[model samples]
Target: MLKSTMNQNKVQTLKGFRDFLPEAMAVRNYVKNLLIDTFETFGFEPIETPTLEYSSVLMGKYGDEADKLVYSFTDNGDRQIGMRYDLTVPTAKVLAMYSQTIPMPFKRYQIQPVWRAENTQKGRYREVLQCDIDTFGTNSPIADAEILAVINTVLQKLNFKTFTILINSRIVLNNILKACKITEDKNSILQSLDKFSKIGQDGVTKELIGKNIPKAKITVLFKYIKQAQPDEYLQNVINQLKILGVSKNNYQFDPTIVRGLDYYTGPIFETVVTKPK
Candidate 1:
């Protein structure tokens, strides 16, 4: 009876969380190792931070939408804490704490699991592993170009044949907002614009209109953005990529590639598989 009861009471993983059996774990480990090898080849050192942090450390860092997704609670000691959302913010705090000790232009890689309170979707989860490589303390365009090179190298090593890296700058989008005379909150408009790829032009227009942005302004914004070209700084980054030998076929300028994250200041990149879904 006890054995039958135990079998009946077997526990399963929570929604949006998963358990990996040996076969799945093996593949995960192999891919992680490959990523580490590629990052190290580009001179990036690994670093790690705690999975839990004071709520104060994370709040007000990733914007309002992201803040809502943070898993925060009061602990037994009554100290508010939150799970790690991404590696970038913690890495920023680390840089601030160790600024005097760490050298300039610090390049580091971190691969860790992050937690978010996201609604379950096909592939979206409350907990997901993120691999990040970041360079700090340098404003040089070469560093940006090197990131593109590393991306190309890793994709080629992974044997992905037909993928395109969409590149853009938030600066360009912000300038567009100004040129369009958009008096509404820019983040709101940009958030909708960021959905262009997922929802397409008509969908984004509907979203913007729902936000009460004038239709005329939306039209002007669309027309102006279509005519917008890469500015001098972005062109310089592209030139550096050519000098670094990253394939020109692998990337292109995309004004519509505005990332959803609120922290992106300069260039941003997203890779899409063209040949496969």
Candidate 2:
């Protein structure tokens, strides 16, 4: 007997996801192609990886709150598997797997969709597209400048103006937090504070309080978080970049911008559209 139409699965996409109609897809393709061209122009070669990776490989890298949002499951073989949350970790894995074949100082660009099972906000979803360019095996300041240039190029090419590039250093934030008696669970605390923009100071206070971080400790930490960055390393980086001829107009030194990724050992930055909502 044939299955009844009523009993069939509905042709609907999951929550936090949507069907991209032709027009929307066209716009997406145009933007993605533009980004790809920009990356290639900067000498970043393209690379791809599997969308699914071992949960073990992804976990403990993005910190606690992020790990909680990973779409993970145990396969029939009893191996824990997870969808890629970001492109960086998988690229590291690819480099490790093909180290013999890959050359030193690999410069690669990967464009793909990443998954994170969380409450979707406007223009943010459980699954979202990402375009990334990464370089490894180098500690040169020039590499950092090229990255900033690529970012500026991509945004300018997309006709974006009035955007701010907020920069911070995990090492700096970690030092400040350590002085606050938060000698451990730093990522958990950082992840909690990561919600400050969305949930406000009181919300972050509540989260850290629930984490058993002393109220006094949170108070001390928030004090320094609101202050200007006392770390000179990032300041020196800024000066170097200025010497490299990158514009200082878009640079913002936001101490509270502790990215919730455990693997971020040094500097971290994000571009924000400052247009009025």
| lDDT tens digits by residue: candidate 1, 93-160 | 89989999999899999999999999999989999999999889998888888888888888888788
Clashing pairs in 2: none
Top-scoring candidate (TM-score): 1
Runs with alpha carbons beyond 4 Å of true place in candidate 2: 1-10, 74-79, 119-121, 199-216, 230-232
In the range 157-193, model 2's lDDT, one tens digit per residue, is 7887668778788877888887787875777888888
Worst 10 residues of 1 by lDDT: 268-277
Task: In angstroms, give how far residue 118 of model 1 lies from its true place.
Answer: 0.8
